[model samples]
Target: MTTTEHTPAPDAGIQTATGSHRKRLMVVLAIYATIIAAQIVGSLVTNSLALAAEAMHMAVDASGILIALIATILATRAASAKRSYGLMRAEIVAVLINCLLLFTLGGFILFEAVDRWFNPSDVAGGGVIVFAVVGLAGAATSLVILSRGAKESLNVKAAFLEVMSDGIGAAAIIVSGILNVTLGWNRGDALAAAAIGVIILPRAFLLLKQAINLIMQGVPAGIDLEEVRESIVDTEGVDEVHSLHVWGLTSGVSVMSAHIVPSAAATDAGEHPRILDELTMIMRERFGIEHCTFQFEEASHLGHEGLMHRDLAGLTSAPSVSGGQHVGHSH
Candidate 1:
């Protein structure tokens, strides 16, 4: 069955949080953009692989914040009939793209680091030190700006964590440069780059997994399917539930739909409305699910051949029964 849904406006319940995110993200974006340009030139001048890799990472961060900023602005748009949910998912999409890109970049940096370990390159220590310090300052400032709203939503958290890691990465580059200057250890640059990759790969993979799950309409984190089903089954009037579905639309939003068979006694007593209220209240309080839809039906509807969503519809309807035997594939 096509699930019935009621979508709130794009900015519904999020304006205050995302409003602050917009201003902070723009400031952070500008800082990262400037750092990318400066660090790229510095990396070329010093021929430091670590510095170069950090610059590329910062470039990706800049792009992430840029996308985040756009998403924040789009999130403010009013919900229209054509775009009922508005563009709140824009933030989710932006974070998804950023994570995939980060994963790819981590692989590239690791490969280069290993190659450099075999055949070392000349790294100008003094130049690397100066640039790394400058980058660290910028990354630190940006981190402070983003950290304030890091817990507000997924988008804000991604931006905050990215900048925080970059700040550490910048410090590593500085350490590598010092080792290169004092001991002629060019290998430190490659080691530093590899370390950066190690830092990035795990975080990137975690974020990628989360984004793909959301895109595939999986259940939200921290929600248990069995528990939800039990709550509904325990309700006074509901005898059975089928076609139950739960999924997250984006951050801070959960949706659910189900088909329920009412108890014969409850039907005779006209307690359907009370049962619905109890079920709804349980879902809201126990599971924190505010949006739900349920279809109430009699047990006799179970074998209705033309019923949608009960099974796939085609020239042949679902196998009902045969003689005294059940005629269907056993799951």
Candidate 2:
């Protein structure tokens, strides 16, 4: 695999994104601490399953927050020989881990809900309500912090979405507590827990899928391969483009590489620089790709009429070596 460096946007300013992320992380840590304390107290006093479940969920939230904080710190580190990418993808990995944690918690809750269905347990309604209200406040704080930073970075955005989803879960628990208190509906508690799990499931899956795709070097979601090819081909000194690939190292940071055939009329050495400039601009403006590599070659030097022919006959064809055929090309 090849690596390409990015030139930060001029208007992006200096370290503003990192500063905003740090602020959000501080807020999240405070909120998580408060909620965990409240939930632990509520769980002890009421001995309610709902309160205990919320406490456990809060623990997961705390862990996720810590992970995000660490990721942010690592991401800001200057590049070194040991890790040249500067730990930018650490945030993406953190998001993936958070999603996995949520899914695991959801599964555990679902299993408990299934068992409770057969053998229901009594829950303290008043305590459940009180703690849930407190939890909602924490969730709301998290939402505000996350929303503020979501536009700044993809990792931060992912963390924000996770917190937002947790907030929704808190809201559901609150409603369940209310129903249990007023109507004496014990099953309402389990139902609410299950509902929380349900809400988290889709978001977890979505985040996990995105993280995996990034890890696999799949094309960034917003870029269209066909559109990229078309744009390159339309460039003034380019006859055609092929074997183009685009992917993200992390969100908002995309890299691309392609093979280009220089137009027949543009053979002068002076024209290569102009071609490169046009190709780079096209990639940035049309495809939101800032990092790119173009391998330029004259069409005649390609030793075939087109990319398809070169792939099928010129490159892949068997060649006599000694007295036998060499069947494949080695890098």
Candidate 3:
């Protein structure tokens, strides 16, 4: 006989986890709008490459904030029969698009910086400093507003990183401005622009990798599949585990499912629920897995499955007790 059961996730908790930072994201967007305008005019007037790059940085960040806000709203929607997970993945999708935008802007900035380095030009350093300071102050305020939410949501985290990079770019522009005014080093502006570009590319790539992993249903960060398997096998009544899968539905939520073989004694004694309870407690307390599904069966079940579906199971004999089959992309 086989039994399957699940520990369900709370609806309210999922909503709270995904959508608690909408207002903060809106505030950040407002700040970006004001800063972008100031920096754009400052760049044109001062003819400073560093100031222009910072303006482009702020513009992209402003756009990302808007997308993040929309995603945050979408993630709060209730689940439906057709879409069981609701729109929780919206934030992740938003992140993927934002990463693309960041990469494009970062690449352009780098190209410009390189060209400017070869042909250094005059820059009005005193005027550029005024705009850089204004941008820096705006970046600082946005950072404070989004800091709390960054830890809670990936959407907010993306916005937070953008603002943080803008802040750094602004500081770089200030240094370049000082050098141009006091030391007549026009190359400093090019150097600062290059630094800002270098900063942006790595962060964009990292965020893109994370979003792709989530979309592919790869195991969430900090979760070790081997550790989880070992813990379950160490349970008193569980003889073995097979077909185990763990992945994230979105941030702060992890789901796991596995087939378990129970000891003959435990099966005969009708202690299936007890074994499940212990495993569930371990998963929740230790692994932060809120949704779990477990199937209890006899050891012969794997052999039986192999006999019925040899092509799929790829097993010519009884499966090993030490481990289960872990399927991955064929390519």
Candidate 4:
């Protein structure tokens, strides 16, 4: 029914897909939870808006990493009829939720910080610096743990970046604490909070855009669709390629489908199988795209049925100039 280079064993496939990835998330969860808990207590004791904002940031990040862990665990489950991709998109969904949470809280913190700037509050400078130092140490340790796996997935990257920002927040609080002690500038705490918000909002929206693109089936980053099309078209025994679609199931896995019209002159018996093998190998080894579907067909079906590619715009396709074939369609 289908062709593949090799089928991995079930358990090994599961491990390769998500076992180690889940472990990566698991390894960082307790560390983040500890940081969140510590920051919450520190904020309460010091009455520092900057430290409070950092605590809120860590809370959102801890929840996001938990969701990523859950997604990876679900991904380890075998694929089924209803859930064909086996919950890989769950990581993207977690990323979407994470971004939304960050944006909402970041805005709230920004507003609060601005208000505090007009009417500064007295903060305990000694407690603020002590808490900031502890938070910095925690954030640094988390970063060290996550550095190896940060590039593994979008979900992991979001979590890792959140910690990185928290580290910056801690540094900001430390500076504010010093200013409060030496210069008697109580508004320094509010300034630190605003700085944290400014740093957070942009990164959150960027991750939000990436999540939307992946959900819309747009091509993943660092990949060129035209490059993929040209590679397939230039392959031996292939003619015109059409309806080529490329997207990711998750950050690390890409899937594609295309209709390949084979050259008639080279259409000997059992020839397409070899061509299919070559195509499969090309996608796997060349493009790092292992999950691909290529339908081999004759050129007569070029402008007919689903093989003509999809018309995404709300307009009828014009007839081809060569054959005057009408390409009217709707979705």
The top-ranked prediction according to TM-score is 4
The sequence of per-residue lDDT tens digits that candidate 4 reaches over residues 51-167 is 999888888888888877777777767779998767767778778888888999899999999999999989998889988898899889888877767676777778788889989
Task: Write the residue-wise lDDT of candidate 1 on 246-325 in tens digits.
Answer: 88766556778877777788888988778777877777778867778877765445456344655521213444533111
Q: Report the error of model 3 at residue 198, Å.
A: 1.4
Candidate 2 regions off by >4 Å?
Answer: 1-6, 11-20, 151-154, 300-331
TM-scores of all models?
A: 0.77, 0.81, 0.85, 0.88
Clashing pairs for predicted structure model 3, backbone only = none
Candidate order by decreasing TM-score: 4, 3, 2, 1
Off by over 4 Å in 1: 1-20, 75-84, 137-152, 305-308, 311-331
Task: Give all candidates' CA lDDT scores.
Answer: 0.78, 0.71, 0.82, 0.77
lDDT of 3 at 276: 89
Candidate 3 lands at a TM-score of: 0.85
Tens digit of per-residue lDDT, candidate 3, span 72-118: 77877888998887888887888888899989999999999999999
User: Each prediction's Cα RMSD?
Assistant: 5.1, 5.8, 4.5, 4.2
lDDT by residue (73-142, candidate 2, tens digit) is 7777777899977787787888788888889987888777767656777778877888888888888878
lDDT of 3 at 284: 89
The C-alpha local distance difference test score for the whole of candidate 4 amounts to 0.77
